[model samples]
Target: MKTMKTLLSASLALTALSGCQPETEKPNILFLLVDDMQSDAIAALGNKNVYTPNIDGLIAEGVTFTRTYTNGALCGALSMPSRAMLMTGRGVFEVQSDGMKIPECMVTLPEQLRANGYQTFATGKWHSDHASFNRSFAAGENIFFGGMHPYEKNGHCSPRLYHYDRTGQYKETSFIGEEFSSKMFADAAIEFLSTAAKAQNPFMAFVSFTSPHDPRNQLPDYGKKYKAKDIILPTNFLPQHPFDNGELAIRDEQILPPPRTGEQLQEELALYYGMVSEVDEQIGRVLNALNATGEREHTVIVFASDNGLAMGQNGLLGKQSLYEHSVGVPMLIIDPRSKKHGFKTDALCYLYDLYPTLCDIVGIEIPASVTGVSLKPLLEGTTDKLRDDIFLAYSNQQRALVKDDYKYIIYNVEGKITEQLFNLKKDPKEMANLADAMPQKAAAYKEMLIQRLKEQQDFCNIDTPLWWKDGHKITWDELINLYIFE
Candidate 1:
């Protein structure tokens, strides 16, 4: 396979030493992406409650990026901008949010792969605008144009699934019936792999699954797999957020009535974990399909989520918050030919970095407009880290800067200003806010955040001192009342 020089050298050494023969052609890429999955939710990574044999298998067979974060969302529905950044390899401040429309000027990951003679195919959710989706994939099936829908329904429910012909036309299809989203997407991918067995050119299958997002529902047996009472609550779980972080009235936060109890949240967590396990079973089906086609050893499999979710952490039920449960996601890249298995790196990276990193892995030139850096060094065992600091922003209301072992967060909604700082090394859950205790360090991080925002051209009108001077008083009762509808 055509890969980075370092990877090529390492592969050659392994092949020579292990007496394994090298292929002369390019390898296939199976891009498996999920929606609204938390980083710590995977069974292999640390969570004991979730049963994810297939995902854990991938972790055992690949290199995992332990510390991967999304740049941030452009709206309350974090999936929109997060998918935009992922597809285009652009920063949060640079992409369009609605439908995650990729600009005409930019080249997407699939588009570049297609240009290089790879048969680019996609299935499942396509949250990006139709124009970009059409431009990226040569063929698509069982495509859900919208972001999310009710995962569980008692009656007959069939969300509209469309088929995108390579000729820029979409055809309505009933190919996807009442099957669960994960199973339906996996079925289509397995079928595609079976069909692709005869193709001469290499393929890039972009299998995107919308599971474990919301309407936390799995099959009856899968849902019953996890017990609500057995699921443990997050360490930072609370009945309500301490203050109004500006998204108190969002639809995700309104999933359940106020005064969320531990038992009820645990039940939701049980369903969420069930859905994760259900998706893992479907992933096993797709991997079996690849192996059945004899392409398992020649294919590169990547597993990641669009963004993360805050299922009960920090008293939030959605991804609108800046907490680790909301921003961090699990990422694994598996190269079947590589000898490195079960290797994990704690290198700081953004989700968009996958674009350039995959391009480098496959020896394809990265697009000019792509701003993400390639993690080829880390993959090739040449480096341990890619980035030291990460910048975050969401809808011009929240801003965060993570450097060293400390994370600084600033929230300005209306005329109120709130700052939070946490030593992530000590308190990864962000339970302690050191803003008032360490004022000088907080100010330094605030300045660093502002400077980083400037570098990203994110001029969101963050009037810090103005709000600091005006001193808008916000009480816990007032913040709680915001979520109470009239």
Candidate 2:
């Protein structure tokens, strides 16, 4: 009887131990970050001109954020700080930009994930400080590929040739610019994935693409894929932007002289679309590799851009102004563990939230210093509120606060404040600015902007630039050699 009782107790204990053992089935993460692709360029996001079938397919199999935003629109303006925010789960202002060093005290997303047993790897574009920030991954590569350069020559700084090892050390490599960089990064990522799969270790692969940014060069064959005459011009296309509205006049001067007649515009659009299509094709390649590795179903894929671009929107070619085309970005998160797939959320979520969201999806406790909230609840279709209001600001040009249906922009450079309250449900174009009609509502938004500015100023240690002073313009090479290399 005693032996039988002992045996029964042992069996019960084994059962209890089995139930208590933590689930070891962790999900792999694949993050695809595009440099300047706009939200409207993807077919899944209502873009009719360009077709991004693979990205759209990912959206159909996951959650797509309709109201996603980036921290800044311009490349140098917000890419570094915004990326820092996304990596650290903190706001740009919260990070101390002392010269070029990212403070050592902060616990970054990759570092945290590494602690949680994730084998992390990254490739392409680390526009932030030295390529060696802990925010990236344990083993990775970073290339400072944000500027414009000649397509055929290697004289200028190319986003493609730039590369760094995990410690942020620049690898000695020849500069070939975009095409080669994309291929190399993709190849490196595939190798990393293969290693992780063999080791049975969950991996976080961050693939940042530098194509479709500038000096727009497409593969010769890819460039030939589209005919210039077939391209369509945007409805908002204009010969010249009516007014500066406190915008940088330098970029305005760069506008290709008009009669930007149908022919020229179509040619430019064709090249742009061709570059985008090349990126889409590369994305499909990566996804196929994942499937071939038998990790497709267990992996979570995220597609997002740093910010949007204005190929021809609002008569702009870059992302400097405070416009929807510049601020909004495409953000899609796919979690196979969740029941809610192919869902759309219009909640105001920022790129900074991605750090915390990734942690949540992997069942890891987010560090206390992170300012962003977990988006899993929102992705799971459990939360109705993602953010009450999103604060948008540029270096010294514009500051705005966006609620559900209203957007208020304060042009600090020109000492002019403009408010546009759009019934997004009715007019998504934002053709009408209702500030003149609804003074009280505009005032409320202005107050919110003021509070946000104050908080940002306090945290960032930034003295708002005096608008009366003239701004300086530096050449691409000069800027890179001076500010970046120094």
Candidate 3:
């Protein structure tokens, strides 16, 4: 029998003889996740208004996915399911959004990496349950275990931080308002990378930032950098949403009431962009830390968001809708070993695909439960497209299918149904509804949507026309009243 070391040498020799690339050292992974960040918000991605020098620096060294989206959202709290899908490499419809828990049986990305001799660390917004966080990461710090924080009138508050002790018990530490959430999390991540520099095993660090989400309270310095009047409103912005989409009563929609003025939207945009810029600075700090530790070229960086936000798009102020602004998010990946930097692909992909893609990059076997396809081939320039089209769903209210340059959207709920179709290349804002002129295309897309639903085991009854029930067509007010708001 061959000795273990002799067998490894022989395997590598055989691989070299076959003209295959030899295995290299596994790279460290730094995954940066932001909340409610729209695809167009990044300055590097052509959003002329936002300032994101740090994120843009990564873009210069990475490949940007120009058309990535969240697979689905069961409710208005979209981040829960979005993060769940990201953690477990599962589809939105297949996970439990409530309690934000990942099944115990499932292997999370961090968990798998830890099992493969990588030290896993996490910090920042953990909207998912504590059990999943504790299970996935070997260590954590400055973690927020719940959803959005309460509004601070003076923009000051004492937030608590939590971390896992050696005994595995989570301990809480009181925090002062001096440091903002972004800085706190980034500081923790920088410290983690510094410590990881001394460790033999490579580290996998998840730095999740909760910013550009809500309360629009930008840091004073960052806020002063932008003027509201100079901010441009989205071209698709509407004073009010035309009809009820089953989520009209959600808290997110109430950010501004009907007849939203351009001034208010611009003001809000300034503050939101300010927060994004601040987050970009924090990212820069972390990157500088990576470089300081002499790990810059040996680490892989992934920057993405849990989901995108509307921010006054299509007469909406939230992510409950299926528009590009609401569902499409920025995904940037930088691998130092690859020569294909500053590349981009328009291929359709869900955020969950990152799990398998990272696994493929690190030479780990993807988990059996993972439904997302690896983008290694696409990233390596061996393929142009990983998928041809995409499907999006939000609650039982909205459905959309995107193929080529055409997007078909359906709003079905209660006793009303509406259809919309737009040639995205011609009308990226979805300003033109071609369902009437293109009935055949709409019918074909409806069939295609049904087929995708069946494949995903979504059993929503969408066959029947929802225009009339009990001898009356549903009114917008009635639909709004049906929602139970907190």
Taking the tens digit of each residue's C-alpha lDDT, what string does model 1 give over 413-463? 776789999999999999999999999999999888878877887745454
What are the root-mean-square deviations of the candidates from the true structure over C-alphas?
A: 9.1, 10.0, 8.7
Model 3 stretches with alpha carbons more than 4 Å out: 1-24, 152-157, 165-177, 218-224, 465-486
Rank by TM-score, descending? 3, 1, 2
Superposition error at 363 for model 3 (Å): 0.5
Q: What is the Cα-based lDDT of residue 390 in candidate 2? A: 85
What is the per-residue lDDT of model 2 for residues 336-372, given as tens digits with 9 covering 90 to 100?
8878778998888888799889988988889887888
Candidate 3 C-alpha lDDT tens digits along 336-397: 88988889888889998999999999988898878888988877887566777898887666
- Clashing pairs in model 2, backbone N/Cα/C closer than 3 A: 132-168, 145-159
TM-score for each prediction?
0.88, 0.83, 0.88
CA deviation > 4 Å runs, candidate 1: 1-24, 150-157, 171-176, 217-224, 463-486
Give the C-alpha lDDT of model 3.
0.78
Backbone clashes per model, in order? 0, 2, 0
What is the alpha-carbon lDDT of model 2 when measured against the actual structure? 0.65
